[model samples]
Target: MITLSETSLDVQQAIQTATRLKAGAVNVFVGTVRDNAKGKAVLRLEYEAYEPMAIAEIKKIVEAAAAKWPLQGWAISHRVGVLQPGEAAVVVAVSTPHRADSFAACEYIIDTLKETVPIWKKEVLEDGEEWISAHP
Candidate 1:
């Protein structure tokens, strides 16, 4: 499953989607908006994306991960629009027959998604705001 949500991301929903009877491990990664960045106090984050393109890129990442491992299920939920500190910006969950596979697949999904997905973020700071690279 893949989602681009303007509202808060549902972490548990992502986990549930990836849970399977054949899976022994379900690894989850939740990325949250931080309170600070590079010596600046972060107030919030505003995310923008070409939704169709972003989703397509994320699907490609998932397919690549499945080719690398034996996966039971996988789900990715990314939040777009304004987000406050401590709010979940993204959720990635993957289920596999073993703990290691789940861990590796989950990591790959998040890392690759951040690097390749067409999601842009503006870091809103106490003093100013700036657009940052997705890979950064």
Candidate 2:
């Protein structure tokens, strides 16, 4: 499953999806908005995406990871709009019959998403704001 939503992501839902495959191992990675980036103090973050493109890119990452790994299940959820520090920005879950495959695929999913997804972020600081490229 893949999702781009403004609502909070449900970890349990992701877990359940993986569980359905009767996987022996499941790995989940949750990315949260941080209070600091570099020396800047972050008040919040706003995510905006060219929706159709972003979703297509995310789907491609999922497809590639699944094809390269022995994945029993995989899921990714990315949050949009305003987010406070410590709030989840994204989650990627992967399950497999073995621990190694699960871990490796989960890591690959997150890494690929960061590198290829078309989601852009605006850092909202106490004094100002700046837009950042998703991969940089």
lDDT of 1 by residue, 49-104 (tens): 99999988998898899999999998999999999999999999999999999999
Model 1 weakest lDDT span, ten residues long: 127-136
What Cα-based lDDT does every candidate model obtain?
0.93, 0.86
lDDT of 2: 0.86
For residues 1-136, write the lDDT of model 2, one tens digit per residue.
8888998888888877766457889999999999998788999999987789988998888888889887888788899999999899998888988899888999988988877888888999878999987665
lDDT of 1 at 107: 94
Q: Estimate each model's TM-score.
A: 0.97, 0.92
Q: Judged by lDDT, which candidate is best?
A: 1
**Residue 20 CA displacement from its true place in model 1, Å:** 0.4
Q: Which parts of model 2 have CA positions greater than 4 angstroms off?
A: none
